[model samples]
Target: MIIPVDQLNPDTLNQVIREFLMRQGEDWGLAEGHLDDAIQQARDALVQGNLVLYWDENEESLTILSKEEVNQSGLG
Candidate 1:
């Protein structure tokens, strides 16, 4: 379920991420500012090289998690 970083195309990844955030906003009924903050956090994680995208087979979804957490869980 965990996808390798090398396997993803960056553009597709970005699009998926954008959609995920938008969906989250709608699902949670978040305000614009709150959604913006969440988006910024995601961007910061990527900038810090602390997060990666993975494909969850069971859920058939993508997720972002800290690198350390991923490694600790033996999912990397």
Candidate 2:
């Protein structure tokens, strides 16, 4: 299930983005240095609808994904 970023509290939204960055491991670029900046970037993506939050109901895991991924996964 996909959750709207707006549906989350500010703190929870930030935590989700941070966790996603950790899991991405530099895949989206430089997950190591300047954590705050990276997180802000992710937040911007979410605000712009370029990124979305996905909840894996069965596994009870949460993740961030691009708009294309959401579409491809039929979660959009």
Candidate 3:
């Protein structure tokens, strides 16, 4: 299911973003010093609808994905 960005607590969302970024590592092409910038970008994408927050019931996990990525993957 897709959770709207505004619906999540700001602190929780921040932590989630941090975890996602750490997991992505170099895949996101983000340097260590640019973490704050990257997080802001991700937050902006979510608010602008360019990205989405997905909840997988079976996995009991939350993932952040681009709208195109979700649609193309048939997850949207």
Candidate 4:
């Protein structure tokens, strides 16, 4: 579910993003710091308007993806 940027509360939204990255770190066998880096990258993408944030009901988590990239990934 894509959330409009204006609809999110920044502090809560960032916490959700951080939690998602930490979970991804565990899934990907990445170390602690790696998750932090990934979260930072996602934020950068959001700032650049290259990505948007959404909630995944299945995973009960937040995710980030570029609109075009997501369409190409066949995951959305």
- The prediction achieving the highest lDDT against the true structure is 3
RMSD of each: 4.3, 1.5, 1.4, 4.0
Which residue segments of model 1 deviate by more than 4 Å?
A: 1-33
What's the count of clashing pairs in each model shown? Answer: 0, 0, 0, 0
Q: How would you encode candidate 4's per-residue C-alpha lDDT over 9-75 as one tens digit per residue?
A: 9787678668766666664335755766676776776777677776778999767667796688665
Q: Which of candidates 2 and 4 reaches a greater TM-score? A: 2
Q: How does each model score on TM-score?
A: 0.52, 0.86, 0.87, 0.55
Give one digit per residue, the lDDT tens place, for model 3 in 2-60.
99898899999998888888887576557665888888888898899998999999999
- Residue 75 displacement in candidate 1 (angstroms): 1.1
Number of the top-ranking candidate, with TM-score as the measure: 3
lDDT of 1 by residue, 10-67 (tens): 7766666566677666543355557656666666666566777777788888877668
Deviation of model 1 at 8, angstroms = 6.9
**Which is the winner by lDDT between candidate 3 and candidate 4?**
3
lDDT of 4: 0.69
lDDT of 2 by residue, 30-55 (tens): 64577788889999999898998888
Model 1 TM-score is: 0.52
lDDT of each: 0.68, 0.86, 0.87, 0.69
**Residue pairs in candidate 3 whose N, alpha carbon or C atoms collide under 3 angstroms:** none
Error of 4 at 70 (Å): 2.3
lDDT-based ranking? 3, 2, 4, 1
Angstrom error of the Cα, residue 7, model 1: value is 7.8
Ranking by TM-score: 3, 2, 4, 1
